[model samples]
Target: MTQHPTKTPQFFLTSPSVCPYLPDQQERKVFTHLVGDRAPELNDLLTQGGFRRSANIAYRPACETCRACVSVRILAEEFAPSKNQKRVLKRNSDLVGTLYPAEPSSEQYDLFRDYLLARHAHGGMAEMSVLDYAMMVEDSFVDTRVIEYRRRGPDSFLTGEGEGELVAVALTDEMSDGLSMVYSFYDPKQEDRSLGTYLILDHVRRAREAGKPHVYLGYWVKGSRKMAYKIRFQPQEHLMPAGWERYQPD
Candidate 1:
């Protein structure tokens, strides 16, 4: 077998642990360091192949006898928001998004804490500390950015932006093929707004406006309510044996 120099790249596997989404299934991941000149290319490929990046590592769920986690990418250029999607867009009309370097701020941390407590208090990321949040946002080799969504103020007409508290944020990775939404959080209190869906919609717009064809949305695990939402973005591509194939809702 022809071996690439990356074969020996630092590798490790997580000990069997409780799966956050599944009731009784345990989960584990085998990961490798994503560095060197090929890191960007590898990261993009990994993302398409159903892996997610954390800090400097790109890893995927390698559960025994399980293939439930599927990678999904939104075809941004071809995206046409459904009637409900349009509602989500109009719902957050008062907000403006600013793209900034992937640096964590105390304000961001506070919002993150509130989000976890309200939405995923029982999930894996609930115990993450402020420093952990910083590493999650700041530790990266490939280009990363933070989009902060706030309310519009008086100068909103000139800037079309807001000066109110940050209501939502997305940590994204800029790739050659698309913008990978690494992670996103929003004010959970505004349940009526469905801000999570709004962020995904916004990224779809940003990706299309930037001339990118796809918006990587990480993995969508079967039967996982937390991930089922990814499937709603129609005309997306799901990685399969023959490579990315279009997935249209039934």
Candidate 2:
């Protein structure tokens, strides 16, 4: 009888660094490469285990003392848009989202650059060049798609595609259970449209239509003002040591 060897993923730990979301704190990460024919399956499993994918890597916070980062996922079937979310949807009603293969474009990079410069000038991604942006969008082994949000054109109803300038872009991964939002960016000039929140709401609708139960939203740091927006999506599940449980913040 031939025996098949069990393949185990190799993980590496990063050196301690200043936490980006929290002050007076340090952060470390345990990450492994997501490659090979099994990359998609591995990504889905790791994501369900509280790991997040970046490019071809899967990483999760492994801080020594702080456990502030919590994985969150929205219950797509049960998600009800609040009054404010409804308003956001109505505001962006003229926009349409079309999913495309994982390919990079100059227009997408331009918007990404502008968003970083305006909203995250001091963040690490501020230094990303066009090439870096391409890698972020296309250097993936899993089943990934780039959804471009644009103004609805005259023929949009016929083609189911958007036209005109790209207003927002979401890099997402299709998993067995749900859609995992890897990263997203939007035109800062359209702040009143609340494009960020609208993107999440759209994903929930997309997931529900695809028969998916959840929409992974990455980590929600408890004390980070920037991360506080994630909690606004109610009826979400927070991955806990016990298991994923309902989280309704007070």
Candidate 3:
């Protein structure tokens, strides 16, 4: 019998760039390709160590002077939605989210473009082309899925499929322990619905129904207004030097 040797993933460090979440700060990332036969397992291990997946790459902030980016995961089973979150859920009750295999569609790209233009016009992904969007959605090696939210039709209960126009979409990774929301976008026109918060609430529900323990919300940078909403999901655990510890917000 022949034994196969274990292969180690090659990690690389990115050059410093302007930090998108904070002003007057430089950001660097330590990343590795999540590919090959061991990609899923590697992804789980790295994610536990504070890495987040983007397509086929797993990266974590490696800023030399900033320790603000903290990995966060909601304790789904213990999560109790606040009044505001409940209101968000009620607002989106007419919408239904259906999970689909990791595949790209022109509809998804259109919404993504509009979202970037409206909310993150100067962000790094603002200029992503259709091909770039496709790569972002489909170029993953681990267990990934795209959740599409649309208006519920009369027959939706029977078919488990949403009808009407696409309102939002979330690119998610199914992990051994829970689901990781890699990226999410919604129709900018429906800002009043607070679709972003609805998406997170939906994921928490999904994780609970699936008997998953956590729902990874990526990095929450302290003092970053844009990331402050992440802290709203309470009973969450943050990756600390001693391992994941319960976060106590002030």
Q: Which residue runs does candidate 3 get wrong by more than 4 Å?
A: 1-6
lDDT of candidates 1 onward, in order: 0.87, 0.94, 0.93
Q: What local lDDT score does residue 125 receive in model 1, on the 0 to 100 scale? A: 90
Q: Residue by residue across 1-250, what tens digits does model 3's lDDT show?
A: 1122228788889999999999999999999888877889999999989999987888999999999999999999999999999999999999989999999999999999999999999989999999888989998888999999999999999989899899999999998999999999999999889999999999999999999999999999899999999999999999999999999988
Kindly report which residue stretches of model 2 are placed more than 4 angstroms away from their true locations once superposed.
1-7
TM-scores, all candidates, are: 0.92, 0.97, 0.97
lDDT of 2 by residue, 208-231 (tens): 999999999999999899999999
lDDT of 2 at 136: 90
Tell me the spans in candidate 1 whose CA falls farther than 4 Å from its real position. Answer: 1-8
